[model samples]
Target: MSAVVDMPGAAHLVLADGVVHLDPEPAVLEAMLEGWALQQRTRFLNWESTIRPRIALVRRLTRFTNEYPWQWDPAEVEAFFDHLRTRRPGRPLAVSTARNYQNDLRLFFDYITDTRYGWPSMCNERFGRAPVQLLHEWNTITHTSEYEGAAERRPLAYDEVQTLFDAADGRVGEIRARRRKGSLAALRDAIVLKTVYAFGLRRQEACGLDLCDLRRNPRVADYGRFGAIFVRYGKASKGGPPKRRSVLTVPEMDWIVGVLDQYVSEVRPAFMPGKHPAFWITERRDRMSLRRLNEAFETARQAADLPPELDLHSLRHSYVTHLIEFGYPEKFVQDQVGHAYASTTAIYSHVSDEYRNRLLRRSLQARHGDLWGQET
Candidate 1:
């Protein structure tokens, strides 16, 4: 008889002569989970944002089922999710969140069950069973709708945009009047908010911008170095690096050129960030964080007294809507936001009723002209 040796700290049952022994140890299981997480980090660009929460979700599920991945079943998954729904009486998970959890579990199981990972093989050799996918299409939530986000989230109206900008600009004067020390920082925050809207940038993308990313557009020489923003950290696909795009300065928003030019020439240098590349910098001369960016927007929004539902992302939505209203092509708008699909771009667009009426009138006029020409 061959004896199985268990590592001291990482003890797990070993198969010998095709006979089953003890249960797999927690240490051995955790090591395998760590390897899976490492693989995910290697493959996904947004892994840093997701890994911790995903690992915690898995651990919670394990605790709920009182079993390891190899012992899990479809019934266990169903029960686990059911428990989640009722875990807090008034705080049930949102439909989209529940679906996301289901998808995350499927991906996790897919990795461990794959023969290349050796998780299934190791389990089968030791415990006479292997991990199988617990969540299936029938059991998971169906993606029946195109836009599953919160109903309250929406683009700001044109007047609301103006009010928000005014609030941001007013913060500078407010600080100065109060003889506060943060007046310069308030000006910087105002410009940052405008830049986010002007470029339709995500919070992280805006935070990631550097001074050098502002480029001169050959087609628009008047705008000079402020003609286009070279976005280096656009939203990424599932397992891809951050996308890149050049957002050209449009004629409607060309006023940003002067604002940026003045800031770069005078205001920014006051921060005394020697050789720092970040366009948005803190008083410490370090790069501005995403949290600070959100705080800036929230401050402005509250001052403007806009809807509570409106957040920093609403600026991006407003950019999409206003561009469509300005009669830019759908394809052009889609590229501006780095959306993988045109449909995703469409979801962001919420044009005004007046703009829709104008489009309808133009269509009718063109139809009438064609009819008159046919009669002739």
Candidate 2:
């Protein structure tokens, strides 16, 4: 009924359906064993069952860990991601449950190994076998498929971002009236959205602010010149340190502080929780929800008639694009946007060919002492 092979120093298991031989090729055998160990480590933690979403979270965490061999194998890594790529939000799964099945799998296989340890494992143990083959299938199928979301990144135009901001501002006003019946609440939301664009904060970072944190920052050389908002949580947190990050720019800092002062003086006390440690308060006066902030941002974008795909995160993209358009170097833009990878900033640099040529021609004119000719 089933094919079987035996080899020295090997074990075999036979079942009604077939026989499974552990006499794998040396490379295959080593990869399998390492994968097993990684799975066991993942299972012991029970992280997906307890902490994060079911699919690919363990793998994501493991990737964050500085482990080896488990982090190295291309096939094993891909297998772990296969589980992730197949996952759908709220779907039950024995392994990988990420929303974007293809992407999760791609990331996993792109970084696995066979000869190191000490870093945490990134594979989901619940998967009986790695789904590395699935990634191959995706690449094969999508090489000519009709699926979307595979498009290259392009920065939103300046007017598009402004319109989205305006939409967000209006919705904040509507929500404030419907929920809290307050004038200042809408104004606060406007200021919050503005700050997000100006400083390119992630939703969590913006919502994680505290009144005290915004009011006081240690990094400012001239505190009076710019507004200061603390970056509390996001991609930049190192070793899970709780130390705050501060962003300062003349008008933006003043805008946030001024709105906050009004909020604290007039609105905050009315909605104050008994003793919550957050700064951005809601109608009931608690720490703002990131989801709610995102929803509000969405509503605003729609109201402003912005493209449907523009999200709160696009503010960060827009910020980077603006910086690049103004001729800031990629490295400087990367630092301002808190990107460890310059490639991320590169996506926002889709400046038009016309714009690029204009700048180039202007540079030549300035060099040749014919600046007014180009200006004319």
lDDT scores for all predictions? 0.84, 0.54
lDDT by residue (tens digit), candidate 1, 69-148: 89888998999889988999966667899998998889888877766656676778667898898888789999999988
- Candidate 2, which segments miss by more than 4 Å at Cα? 1-51, 54-156, 171-185, 215-226, 236-244, 250-257, 327-329, 352-358, 371-376
Best by TM-score: 1
The positional error of residue 104 in candidate 1, measured at the CA in angstroms, is 1.5
- How well does candidate 1 score on lDDT at residue 91? 68
Local distance difference test, candidate 2: 0.54
Using all chains and alpha carbons, the TM-scores for the candidates as numbered come to: 0.85, 0.58
Listing every candidate in turn, what is its Cα RMSD in Å to the true structure after a full C-alpha superposition? Answer: 5.4, 10.9
Where is the poorest 10-residue window by lDDT in model 2? 7-16
RMSD in angstroms between candidate 1 and the native structure over all alpha carbons: 5.4
lDDT for residue 150 in candidate 2, whole number 0-100? 24
